[model samples]
Target chain A: MQIARHIAEQPTTIVESYRSAARTLETYAPGPIGRVLLIGSGSSFNAGTVALPSMRAAFAGEVSVVGPQDFLRRPDTVPVRGTLAVVVSQSGASATSLEVARRAAAMGCATLVLTANAESAAAALGLPLVLMPAGDETIGPKTKGYVASVAALQAIAARFGADIADPAELAPNLEAALAAAETRAKALAPALDKVDTILVAGDGADFGTALEGSLKIAEIAGIPTAAYTIEEALHGRLHGLSERSLVLAIAADEVGRTEASTVREALAPHGIAVETVAAGPTDALPTPWCTLASTFLFQYMAVELALRRGREPDLMRYPGLTRRLAIKVDDSQ
Target chain B: MQIARHIAEQPTTIVESYRSAARTLETYAPGPIGRVLLIGSGSSFNAGTVALPSMRAAFAGEVSVVGPQDFLRRPDTVPVRGTLAVVVSQSGASATSLEVARRAAAMGCATLVLTANAESAAAALGLPLVLMPAGDETIGPKTKGYVASVAALQAIAARFGADIADPAELAPNLEAALAAAETRAKALAPALDKVDTILVAGDGADFGTALEGSLKIAEIAGIPTAAYTIEEALHGRLHGLSERSLVLAIAADEVGRTEASTVREALAPHGIAVETVAAGPTDALPTPWCTLASTFLFQYMAVELALRRGREPDLMRYPGLTRRLAIKVDDSQ
Candidate 1:
């Protein structure tokens, strides 16, 4: 599948972004930024969300992730002044995202946009634009785009003084992680195909990965899947689970592992399977690039499961329905 | 089911909270509140989230909802000093809520906690406490407590200069709304019982209603349910649908109606049932009390659907599993 190729392309994307993002940030604002508002939707949103913690640790300003509709809907709640509002749209064609950029700009905020298309409406807004080095992903569910988006945000955080690992040093690790994820996911896809529902759970950085991973599975495999922060699932969402349910836990940290094990033990009695997937190494990248590993795992699993179930992994199961909504514009990458 | 009784107790709970919440807020901070940071998890978080737009309109400063884990996990993202941090817990026993209250207080934010139990660890923090008039919800999934929590936040917004409708006036209206909701839910219960999955979608004020409603269904009905802001669902989650799927759209506002209709029309081609629930009257209450109407509908549907499916509504289908997570402390409710 082309997605497999896209998954393999993530390592180079990260390396190139580390060099380009800093130069772009410098041009946007030479002065130190205060509060950071990273905005996007779907997979784009997940990438920015996954990098939030490291971004916060890198700089003192409040780093927050906002959905395009949420930000546009709530004006009074936004901190505009001295706020660096970065709108990330991998395709640069989310209709609401362009509105967010326009609104953020009009509100006198330092609005910056990162996308693959410079000629797209969002980049045409004349805001500080950073075109991702990640090549085109012509599919509905993104694989390389997710990695590039996260790496872009991490580069921005690193520039802001976060003690991030150099992206150059992670090439071998990313390749190794991707290979391991493919093997693990291929073996697990058959079991996943038999489940009626899937719940992907994680914590901290992995929470963002879980969200993106779940979205990939839902869109690509056409499986009924949901994402949850481990704590949130524990709070209430666990009640609906049954023997037909399968849970994929992205446990990269110690706390995440504990929570994953907790869910595993709790659901085991019900004959539900909770698989803890490969958490790619977090030590050698700008942020916890382990999410990149998760990116590979979920993507591979989705493709394998879709193939086994006789579904198309590259295209959305119901494209006509999604297109009718007009969420993404014609200029979408 | 005690749940039906608890659901019936909502109107009285709303009326009582209007008096108590205001008096409590005035005592805690006689001065105007600038920025608001509402923190909680699950239903508590949903309650605060539902009130955000109204609270923002009530004052100039930012009003935002922060799930306890999200707030605590990202320390740098929080806006502390001079902010009013409202930590909500119907049971006052969310393990992370106590930590959120303590942290907010320590950070010099005007921390206020709302809970039903005066003896809760969260309430006993010696910080300003506003006990909910919600009474004892003693069950795993709350019905009346969700209504009471939303009412309390709305009262606080009213005190902050929001042009809210009097809770006294909502008494008869709420009663009428509740009766209407029960009838609607009863008829739909049989249809709902057959679905393997449910997606509760809404926008604006109804968005919060959608979330709490989904949780209620997932927890009480033992049916796997997910909630999505209509916009978010259109983004990607719409892909994971089948003939067995049911979409419950809370169309409170015009935007909500359009979105709901869109989802309905699109999904109908796939044989998925999309039911647009009643949007309670928006004119009579501060913000939109129509969500309260949705609250009743979702609660009653959850109960009736549970019974039809032979799953107990008042008790969790798997209590031992949820309790094992320790998300809620021993003193919960």
Candidate 2:
């Protein structure tokens, strides 16, 4: 129920997040940036993926996104001249992220710390801090926080003159996505309990959505899920699928639809079922906007699947998972 | 039987590849390079991954590896001034790889085409060509081609002034890895039949080995497999693990051992087993060398497991998989 509320609140959250994102971008780098290195984990990382295409389009010099752990151990070539390291940690309490900010600054790179926790240590470190609008999303698996981060990243790219549409323009699409997604998710969640494996496939920016979708099913629905680009799904990875497998093919673009259809044919012999998520015919959003809105499809399915399995959607199967792993810095610290 | 013989021939293949790799580097650059971008698909991608760390160390400016599909649609920042696009397609017949070479060259970037097929369209384009010693690997899933590509990339980095050990130095280690891996693989082959899923974990350069390991199992053993860095394996993904899950942790360095131990302990509650591949005490090979040689572990297991599963180790479940997808240029072309 709490997650359902968060999902409903995403449209409003995106508006507020956009304002903060614009201000953050100006403060982080007054001039247009030629290079940017983004670092985040889990849902935060997924948000970065949504923005990468536009960000790459804007900054013709260079732009890349890596998870926090990988960024910590990345080559010295990073934080190179004129590079801005954008740290997107909703909690702003990841140990690796804190270390990355310190190292990036020490290496003379411009840095910005984006999070909902303004008092967090990473935010208090004199780094440029931008607070996300989805404040205190107590749920273990995020919905509002996910949309808020997506809004912020897209806004920053748009601010830098990328061909990204305003996040506010997509708010209505978000609301419509949730309503349509709920009916479909409720119907599909029960059958997923019998599946041994779930494969999510997409292309380009849609690949990012597929990954987030896979992560949600595994984290909340307690299913074994894997994400691959549409092309890669046709690669050798298909040999392992069987009658017990389920595939979610994202028809976000022509490329996605064509490849997903090919993949569907390839899996015909194995009795694997593919469910395609195509954009609504009447949707106001276009291209990536409609595609990105489809994240709601996975979010709704995760919640419905969790409750169907007699599990709580808001509470994680392993409470204090991040704390126990020492990935995020302890709030008490 | 075909894949097994190829696995046994890696040490010999690597030696010849190193010779060709050295000559290729001279023909491609002939000087220390500042930036390089490597691209491949599947196994070729994995080989580029193994060589990435040292190559990054060699090129102080920038060094990155990407899949050919991603590279084809990559940001204009790629193939930047002073960048070298290293195309690692063993067959050198992938349409995507050829397209990338043309784009990179047209953008004023130096290019190298590493392949086993001298007559392949990519090599016939008259770009800097380096012949791999894999000869004609008729088998569906490659073993010698993987090691040969690795040798070529590493040799290129070393030629560009990176502190990489000679591939010849690892020949003894490869022989030992194959000998030791065979016994362990044979034992593992039968027990894997009951498993529903497998997760391979590693860190740093070992992460490259994890990807290749995951691929070999999925491609040859007909098992669903996924690979992740040790830290990433712990990030929420652990929640999806069940008793039927098998984990292979690669302890290729101190960082790997420490994180792999942490990962092993994390999966204890789920009753999941974590099998580690650690370097032998007397291994003449050092950190990444010993670690790179660990690819033999997966290669051996894939062959043995295929046989145990009543499948042919030499042929893929779908022999004309790539051809049907139209990813590779037609051999008739």
Candidate 3:
């Protein structure tokens, strides 16, 4: 499948995607936006999380990420006026994303759509667009689309005011990670397959990587995965940990790496296996790019686990379940 | 243990807790506060989430909930001035909570502490305190503390501007839910016990209840639980659904109920057993109270699952894990 190839092309694609949309982002959400509301479902929302820190650093305003349902349920939670809703979706036709975009526009806030499909239903809404540079994606689980979304947002943040690290700086690390993934993923798959539950923990911006990675693992590898902000793993989830559980900790910086190690040591006595992936020393590359590499590694791990289990990575086990709930249509109403 | 009895007394305790803090809340976070930030960890964070809608309705500005680690790591993500940090902790000694309170104060935002202990380290930070009426809970899983935290925030929101449904009005419903929980939880235990993974889904304000309940189940019942917003449950989680998976759908209103039922119907084809807990009609009591009843039911369900598995509900399994992460001491440093 081209999924693995697409994942490997992330370092180059991110820079191209940013360069392609630099001018649009300058005006897409221009003017002192009091708050930036990133709304999406699944991988799209997780992608926003990966770019959240840079957005916060760029703008002297609050940046928040929530699933589309949250905004729909409580529009009052968001600033109706000075807020810009950055609606991200691989397929902009998703009913939830469209509804959120409409609602955001109706509230007099500007809407910006980032997706692989510019001709999608969301485009018909006449919102500003930042089309993914990777173009069309046919895979069931998104690989290129997710990274593109993050990279595009990083471009927007840079235009806004953030001094983001250059994507070109991440090329060597990305190539190294991708080159090493197949062997590492194959080796890790056996241990992961033996586990009943997987907990992926990360701190700071990289926490988004954990969430994105866990979702892919759950979707493709058929593993029951729970990804939390590293602290949350301790707050309540530790009770469910046992010898059968595997903890994959993704750390972007030194403090996060220390905390992840402490968590591993704490769970060691309970016979839980811990796998740590330290992405960077904080200054290696952009925080978002560090997370991209970690996420890419986990994506490969998911494929390897699925391959080991004799299951098709692209064809998820319960194929119909996700499709039925992806978008709701009410003919009766 | 008196945990069950304490959980049952939540109705009366909530009203008393609110009344006791009514004057303090009115003055503590007074005036046209531009935005409100609620910070906590685990159940404390969930409690803030339950109160988010009412707070949004009451305030003219944005209302947000973040774990303490989020605020501490990225204070730039939160507004410095014209914001109030409502910090909730069952025990006022949680190091993370204390650090967040200090950081928010340093940023010139007023700090309000809502906790059971008024003399603990968090209260010693000299912030305004709304002491929990439940008082002196020692259970590891924190059932009463969770409900009490939500009630305290609801009271604060009422004082802010929201015409929240009265806690007194919810007493009857709360009592009814508690009464029904024993039989219902015992019945539901067997089905849940057979599952390899449990997925809990809820929409709107009630989503917080789902999160808190899932945490408790993970803590006490030793289940790998993933609590997600209704849309998130449909996004990528469905790929892991099987005959061994159990879905607990919590609905706070008609729309939520319908959406949850759609989730159930979609997952049914995948052999996932779905349990829907329709909290109330939208206009029943108040959104917060309906969630309270639903949360109470799940608390009992956790207890029942624990008892059925010959585990201690009050003394959670792997007790040392939480304690180790609860405080970070720098002896080596």
Candidate 4:
């Protein structure tokens, strides 16, 4: 809650920090490197999801988000050949991420490392490093760290050429959105307390954000949750839907707003309560949406839900599970 | 074993029949479309893993493999403006796939249905139907169905400009491959009786085949098995490497042969025995490599593995579970 209050107050600071970081790219990254590769693990990966569309729009080329494991496995499949490889890691020393950066470097790629630790292995790859001040981590699961990564990515997007429509004008709006999130988080406390399963749905670019939000709930609340694209939810998965199931619909912009509304309407008729985190009213005719704002809201909601249920909002019991584990690939041998 | 023998003996007949059915694609699919959406559920989707590269290379445009659920909830994202929807289903009446076909038709896109049942909803859609004569199963967990689906896709590829480097010339080699697979299936009885898990790995075009092979083993033998690209295996998952983990590496063609060999050699150093099915001499190599005559060899390997385990090769305990699932979109309503 203290961290949430801090976020509510200094939201603009995070945004400003991100903008500054983005500007640095123009100076550090030289050449016609056709595309961008946003790499991260876990929460950092979630931030990359939000950054992708924005970066793609700004860069006017292909922008893909791949996990460190994916890069290590088949670097060739990645769309960006001889392009910028942006490596994001929370600890900076994430062994898998470090190896990926090394692999990229070995492949003659211009590696860019983004992390909280300036001297991490990922940074040691002799890449231009963008280091952020470490955020609060009451429990190791990552709340503030996630937000900080988002801030960094957002700043990078603004710097590159994002049509963000005036940062000075939008700063107060972002703060207000955070405030709105705080208010909504309190209202949703009861539902979060009882619900064991949550389904988050989004369309297009927001799909990845919904996935990250669902993952956050799973990691923080220790609950079973599945995130899907809005259309994917309409498929066989809806069979698992019941009044008991909490549905979180994330609608970022007009691009997917209609589909999200259709999903909300469909679920509501089935007596399923639908909660939305968007830029405008769920009932609005045409809503202006911000995916970043919506993602942050849901993330905050998940954290509050965990705290209200007496669960540690940041500590993850399932970290380093075999399926999620990352190992350094010593390519030298 | 009898089934394997039957398949081996009638390889040309089966291939020709499947290829003829695949020719129907030209009738339904006329010209270049904006996108090609391939829809399938579970193991059927694995076929897309193979179809993706080939389709993209031939079509030279957007080709995405989506679950039917994804199509239903967000029809707009289905690339309806200018798209060809290909739905792959074993039992033509799969509820989710049916919805996917219906939605694609509603979107005014050319719908191509590939299935074993010509009378199923997929066929009734009145689109281009590639019917596999594999027949319906009284005992069903998708043993023959999986083989039929893969064969159908391959046949379609071969028909639709799939760089088949001398079609008639490849026929004899394919027949021999099937026969070799039958011989290897008979020989594998000893290994099949002992091993609990079969880990399959491939790269590039063959990666999908490896994934489908692993799924077949899991479905039929009811064994815990996993599949990954040769590169993915070297990531963190190699920690599970042991002599007990029966490694089945499918090294096909020039692309993935070297990586597959590297994986085989790496496993050998760990004292883990590796069995490879390839087009070349796998003997001088570290693994016990069998020169397979056809891709069908892996299918027989799955069947033989199941038979040796004393499990009914085709048992679907989760009945209606398939219908309740959506490959592209959910149509439970």
Best by lDDT: 1
- In the range A88-109, model 2's lDDT, one tens digit per residue, is 8777777777888888888878
Q: Give the TM-score of chain B in candidate 2.
A: 0.94
Question: In model 2, where do residues sit more than 4 Å from their true spots?
Answer: A24-32, A279-282, A331-333, B30-33, B279-282, B331-333
C-alpha lDDT (0 to 100) for residue B109 of candidate 3? 85
RMSD of 3: 3.2
Instruction: Please list the residue runs of candidate 1 whose C-alpha ends up more than 4 Å from where it truly belongs after superposition.
Output: A30-32, A281-286, A331-333, B30-32, B76-79, B281-286, B331-333
Best by DockQ: 3
TM-score each candidate: 0.94, 0.94, 0.94, 0.61
Q: Which tens-of-lDDT digit does each residue in A24-130 have in candidate 3?
A: 76556456687788899888888888888888887677788889887887775566656878999777767888899888888888788887776677767787888
What is the CAPRI rating of model 4's predicted complex? Answer: incorrect
* Pairwise DockQ winner, candidates 2 and 3: 3
- Listed models, DockQ each: 0.69, 0.54, 0.70, 0.08
lDDT of 1 by residue, A1-333 (tens): 677777778778887876678677775553567788889988888888789878888767667788888787776577776788889988888999989999988998888899976667877888888888777778767777777888889888877778778777878888777777788887887776568888888777787888888888888888888887777787778778888888888877677778788888988888988988646733443336766567788888888888998987777777666567777787332
- Ranking of all predicted structures according to DockQ, beginning with the best and ending with the worst: 3, 1, 2, 4
User: Global CA lDDT of candidate 2, please?
Assistant: 0.76
Better of 1 and 2 by lDDT: 1
**Please, what are the lDDT tens digits per residue for candidate 4 over residues B132-220?**
76653444444455555655665655556665332234456555556666688678756656553456777644566675666555555
